[model samples]
Target: MGQALALREDFDGSDLRRLARGSRDADQTRRLLALAVIYAGGSRAEAARTGGVGRQIVRDWVMRFNAEGPEGLITRKAPGSPSKLNDVQRAALVQVVERGPNPKVDGVVRWRLLDLAAWVWDRFGISLSEATLSRELKALGFSKLSARPRHYAQDADAIDAFKKTSRPAWRMSARRSRPAPR
Candidate 1:
């Protein structure tokens, strides 16, 4: 039993209908049409029916429209969860990755996702899973790359010396022919 919200007087039913016609967003257009019904002296129930939404939703649309005009009716993507790393932490992470790990100090020849996660936990006190760390790395423009494994005792020169230099030439034998009309 609260007082009914008033629609903005600047735009009338025809203006809303025209805006709806030009709008690219289907949801915005639908909302505009519904509000247009209200502007045309139609009941909230009628507007709701036109919009294919409930009366409460129509009321919300009216409030949004009143505050922000036609632009407010457009649906927007929801803001997702905030990043775990702040700017300073992210910069530090980037620097660590670029500088590479020291085997003597960090106990690793190359950085793995597990090692990175542990490093983050130790440095930032933030526990991140391997997958989450990988995702973060990827978002920060890092790709997973590993050098091909080679045996410690393998000799490159010996391998080159055993390799075939050229293809072996084949010798063809002369073929005997039969009489054509026999």
Candidate 2:
């Protein structure tokens, strides 16, 4: 048979249980609980089952707990790729969004993902896809909005008068040319 599973000599079953009970992190508490079971002379398989993980995982947890104490059992953040834009750049981008783009200079009447992507590339030298730019813009509190199309010479007064005088087609009374049969 392989070497029996065990915890560090310094930590006792009660100490492990107390740490497990006091821990706020669910994962950490689970690891501590498994360690407690192992320390109490329970089989490694039994401890793994109690911890709701595989036997190998419990073994790894025991090794970590023994080597680095309670902190080792806690979950760590997975390192992710750094953002393309820094805080200052993000803030500047937000400001640029808030101050509407100039139509004459930018050659665009309203903002679009393609236009924003081009602008970002030109200003910051960072090329981003339309979808990426869209997500970033959304994160900066900007949303996709398009203005309704209307003629520049349209008169509001005429529209109001038309609305006031017009009757809906559905509301028209049916008129019969022939008299009703007796």
TM-scores for every candidate against the unseen true structure: 0.72, 0.56
For 39-133, candidate 2 gives per-residue lDDT tens digits of 88888899999999899898899888878999999999988766687788788778767776899999887677788778888889998888877
TM-score of 1: 0.72
Off by over 4 Å in 1: 145-182
The total of clashing pairs for model 1 equals: 0
lDDT of 1 at 82: 79
Going through the candidates in order, what is the number of backbone clashes in each? 0, 0
lDDT of 1 by residue, 1-182 (tens): 88779999999999999999999999999999999999999999999999999999999999999999999999999998777888898889999999999999999988999999999999999988898888888999999999887889999999999999887798555555544576
- lDDT to native, each model: 0.93, 0.83
In lDDT terms, how accurate is model 2? 0.83
**In terms of TM-score, which candidate is strongest?**
1
